[model samples]
Target: MRRPDPVSRALTQVGELFALALDTLRAIPKRPFPAKDLLEQFWFVTSVSWIPAMLVAIPFGAVIALQLGTLTVQVGAQSFTGAASVLAVVQQAAPIVTTLVIAGAGGAAICADLGARTIRDEIDAMKVIGISPVQALVVPRVLACVFSAVLLNGLVSVVGVLGGYFFNVIVQGGTPGAYLASFTALAQFSDLVVGEVKALIFGFLAGVVAAYRGLGTKPGPKGVGDSVNQSVVVTFLLLFFVNFVATTLYLQLVPGKAA
Candidate 1:
């Protein structure tokens, strides 16, 4: 059966979020960004996932070195493993992984919490009381996502690099410093720039998508479940597709190509 258009109401909430983000930005007449909230959000995201990330990252880093070793040796390019691993982890994996982690854990949690409030008419009650749910509910989260993504990406970069180093040098007896040094020699200023820029954007995306899904929640358990599932799937896909677009645009405008 076709579902009713419960989503129509959500458009308003989504618009409000964009406005909040924009208004916050515009209020800063001198600066181009909102650093404090962004930083706070980033720290929250990073701190919240520290334990899980540490647990997973160590094994992931170890396995990557072990797996790449066989392939690198075949081409007699064992030395390039560090550089290749670093680039792959930093440029490719980190942002996407952070998004997934947030979506699966933080995003889902937000959606459910908000959706529960929505089902119980708490959101409607807010509207009745002249409360700006956008400010009260959405702003913190949107800001959190933006900052969290940045923070997590930074954390990811550090862990990824160090993990690759330990695995290569200690575990596999490979030249570990190659990966750390690769950023200096192989990567451009633009590469790091775009990666971080994309991280901020991705964070907003995760928040916006999550909030949209959450606010549209209907008065039922099924609706909440659907919202959470959809939020994660949509968000993860959006991150990758958006990442691709950003990379393409960067190469077209910037001095160097990503390839």
Candidate 2:
């Protein structure tokens, strides 16, 4: 049999991944849902990810405040720094930052776990026992990833806002009151809702990609590592594309005044 070309193979792989995701989604409401496993994976994904997420968020928030605050100062609209920085974090930076952590850290962990199991034939063993691996493993993990991402998005948003506040107030010499006061001037409830929705969608996609790469890994230890790496790379690519589309749609749907 002739091997499929690279493009064809890639398309086929994507189709398989999509199908797997659909199957997992269907498995979600099936009776005998794995609550314990879902909770454990949820905690594990969130707990293992928060420190890195915070580390990333602080610099991200600080940089935005530093740049936007400086720009606003030049224009003599310095008091608007809070509104700009807060909106930046709430509408864009937080979800992307949290997703970077999820795709890099959480995706790697899930891929490694599933890859190891595949290399050990554990997945096959479950299949031989008449168990549906998607029901048993993928559903819990996908849900856990989505849940963890939403939670982490909230965490990142808080940390990012705090970082922006400190940098703008102390380093940039903006008044604390100015920073605090301007936050409500431009921000809206819809911005937070959009950010969380982005987080949820990103998390679900990352989990599906990771699980697909993990379970479909080739034989051997090297294959497992390769799968983990591919999972991260693919997830990142998908995320940036998704982020662009989501942000554009969000801006269109809920127009906000520039601060």
Candidate 3:
């Protein structure tokens, strides 16, 4: 038999992922919500991701502040540095950093756990007993990721803004009052709303992708590892693409605050 072409294989995988995502969504509103599983997973995700997210957010914010500070000075718009940096952090960097941590830490763990179950035939056993893996396992994990991402987005945003503020004021000799004032000058509340929205969607995508790859694992120890890696890589790609699209739509639809 002839093997499927690359495009066909890609399309097939996309179809399967889409179907899995649909199943997860449908399973979400069903009876007997897995609150315990969700709480456990939420705690797990938070425990693994929060410190790393904060560590990364600090440098991310500092770099944005440094770069934008330099650029704004060169352009003779140094007073807008805080607004630019805060907007960058809150509107883009925070959600991306939060989700990256979620995908790398929480998503990888979820993938590995589910993949292990798949290799051990536990998923099949559940199916045989009329238990939906999607409902019993996937939904809670996905919701956990969503909840974690939303909360972490807020945390990262605050940390990032603080980091940026410090770098702008102390390192760049920007006035603290100017820095604080500039934030309200250019950033609208919608900027924040978009960031949270990105976090929510990105979380859902990360969880679904991880679960799909995990459930599709081949029967070997190596297969579980490979699925975990693939899930992270796939989640990262999807997050960036979705972020770009979401940002573009937000820019088009929501008018920026008057400077």
Top candidate on lDDT is 3
Off by over 4 Å in 2: 257-259
TM-score of each: 0.77, 0.95, 0.99
Model 2's number of clashes is 0
Q: Give the range where candidate 2 is weakest over 10 consecutive residues by summed lDDT.
A: 250-259
Query: Who is ahead in TM-score, 1 or 3?
Result: 3
Task: Flag regions of model 1 displaced more than 4 Å.
Answer: 1-47, 63-68, 177-183, 255-259
Candidate 3 C-alpha lDDT tens digits along 173-235: 998988888898888888899999999999999999999999999999999999999999999
Tell me which of candidates 2 and 3 scores higher on lDDT. 3
Of candidate 1, the 10-residue stretch with the lowest lDDT total is 24-33
- Compare the candidates by TM-score and give the number of the best one: 3
Q: Candidate 1 clashing pairs?
A: 42-147, 42-148
Task: Write down the lDDT that model 3 would get.
Answer: 0.95
RMSD, every candidate, angstroms: 5.0, 1.5, 0.7
Cα misplacement distance, residue 104 of candidate 1 (Å)? 1.5
